[model samples]
Target: MALLSYPRRHPSIHLLILSAYALFLLPILDGLELGGDGLYREILRDETVLRLKELGKVIAFSDEEGVRFQTTFLGSAAVAVQDVLKLNSLEGTANALGEVRYSPESVGSYVEVHIEQGPVLEALHYPLAAELVLTLETLCKEPNKFLTYDEECGCFTEESLAGLVCTVGELLTWPSASNVIPGQVNFTVDIRAMDDKVRETIVTSFSRLVLQRCDDRLVDCAVEQKHAAAATPCDAELTSRLERATRSTISSMAAGVRRAGGETPVLMSGAGHDAMAMARLTKVGMLFVRCRGGVSHSPEESVMDDDVWAAGLALVNFIDQNAVDAAAATAAESDVASGFARPHWSQAAHQFGCNRAP
Candidate 1:
């Protein structure tokens, strides 16, 4: 891939969101801002929704590895996002911007966690809006709901999420804390997984955990739909990488273990992306430009030259040797697809099949 003079392999949302922000200048009169996604409700006449908090995990057990062996709580990130954006909180609107109905039992009390969005190109110099939201939402109380619940604690046990790890890679706990309304609230640790398979598994597990809270009823929490990217089948090289991920020590040490059901260990994210999304569809991978102390989703999100160069160097290494093979393979396939020019592996294109010709 021919990169610009900039070194970063992956562009940040903080940097790219400017295009989204520029839309605010349009004359729709209201909204037209990127950070103002909440305004989409007004633009579309959707009502605002309120955020409910009612779930948290009280560790039932932990192994020597210190991994939480059980889940005592669950909640919908969608609902929280809805509240944070104040999408449905608006009164008297016909349609709610973020309306959701679910057994409050499913997702326990609400606590804040980071929603990583915006461009990955931005540096880490600015305030991390995601973190700010994390700071704000965790402090929100459910008034009378979440603080009270009755259950036979000894009966419920959390299921291991071995299956979910297939789509994601790194799962981590941010035991970091923040103050929302100073002197009032703190935060809980978050376990984040980055592998596509692992992420899918985590999402599935989260759904089920909340479902259990629903006491066996159909719930309508906000769900993540597949991204509308130009998706195609996963490539052979990517398939091999996914297979290796399954055997990786990380997968073996997961909380729960399940047998694969002929599903690919890798998956494409509908939204959250990095090299993972690109890697799943093709041999394309991404290198993240930093978020200056992890800031994003605000106008002030940022990063630095050093970080961009680091990302670029990693990207260079990934393609340096594969470029020639890529082109040779393209040309070697006796029959090139209609008008497509066979590429040299050395090209190591960003397009991979993503921008394959129109």
Candidate 2:
């Protein structure tokens, strides 16, 4: 704000201040640091918990910054701890503050709080994501389901198979998007939860979706689904290993220009992250530091000054968008995503959206 201060008395000083302000805004207009925020790290775990709430399994909380996951039992205990400490927003604020500020080693009796080894997003994005994910799998098994293939339509459908692909959201969810990472895209359907019924449903639904898509497109599909299926849920045996979620984000830093121009999608990743380490994830996307937006594994988490200011402005814009309803958007996007070809049984283009009726 001081940057906006008036300095009418000193023209030279005013010039310098103006120069500094311009420098701070450089990243915003020219480019932005493209790194992952804590959001991706927690998407699966968080969404899993929410989806499984109907079952016996329970998750205490989740955020985009995947960290600080606790099952129903532990989550209860943590809530008690929060009440005892009179900590409002304890889970998020404490962890967030811990990461940004360095602290001294526990000094005698007093707990010393200082900046963590590095920035919050870079340090805990992946680890927190892992914890949430592992715990979630322990809860259940995944189900795979697909629509019955319609021989007459030559397309998969429950009743009728002939029609446009769809105008609703396609929900092009990529499993292990990383599989396509340095190689061909790999997909997986994960099911976890104590409720066998739910697990079966998830697996059934996902498998069906994959098969349906593949069948619709004449592509072969496979199922690589698992839940914390082992006898022991928490033991290392039940572990769910995932790639560092930030790789994609870090690589995206090159889009500083796109981000500045608002061409970049300011969307929230439905993933888990090392957010629990910093303890906050829900709105962490709002805090992208903008400088480094680099590889999240390094101690030197940073961003250019310009990037930070740009992100600051961008954040405000993004918050305004939250008011938009997701279901509506999903429906709209599904239509857009599944621009299926014209639906016909005789002869026509077979692409996702090739032929048309009306």
- In candidate 1, which residue ranges exceed 4 Å CA deviation? 1-271, 274-284, 330-358
Q: Per-residue lDDT tens digits of candidate 1, residues 1-358?
A: 1111322222211100011001000001111124311222122111101000011111110011112222111112222222322332435333453443223333211111112233321322221111110101111111111111125663222332221122322333334345333322222323332233333444567657755865565533343432222222333452343233223311223232234442212222222222222222123222222343333434555444333322222222222223334446446675654333322323332322212221
Worst 10-residue lDDT window for candidate 2 reads 20-29
Compared to the true structure, candidate 1 yields what TM-score?
0.27
Candidate 2 ranges with C-alpha deviation above 4 Å: 1-264, 273-294, 297-302, 315-358
Q: 198-313, model 2: which lDDT tens digit per residue?
A: 44544677678878998998876676532223111121211111112222222334433322322222111112222221121111111223223333323444344333323322
- Report the lDDT of model 2 for residue 88: 27
* TM-scores for all predictions: 0.27, 0.21
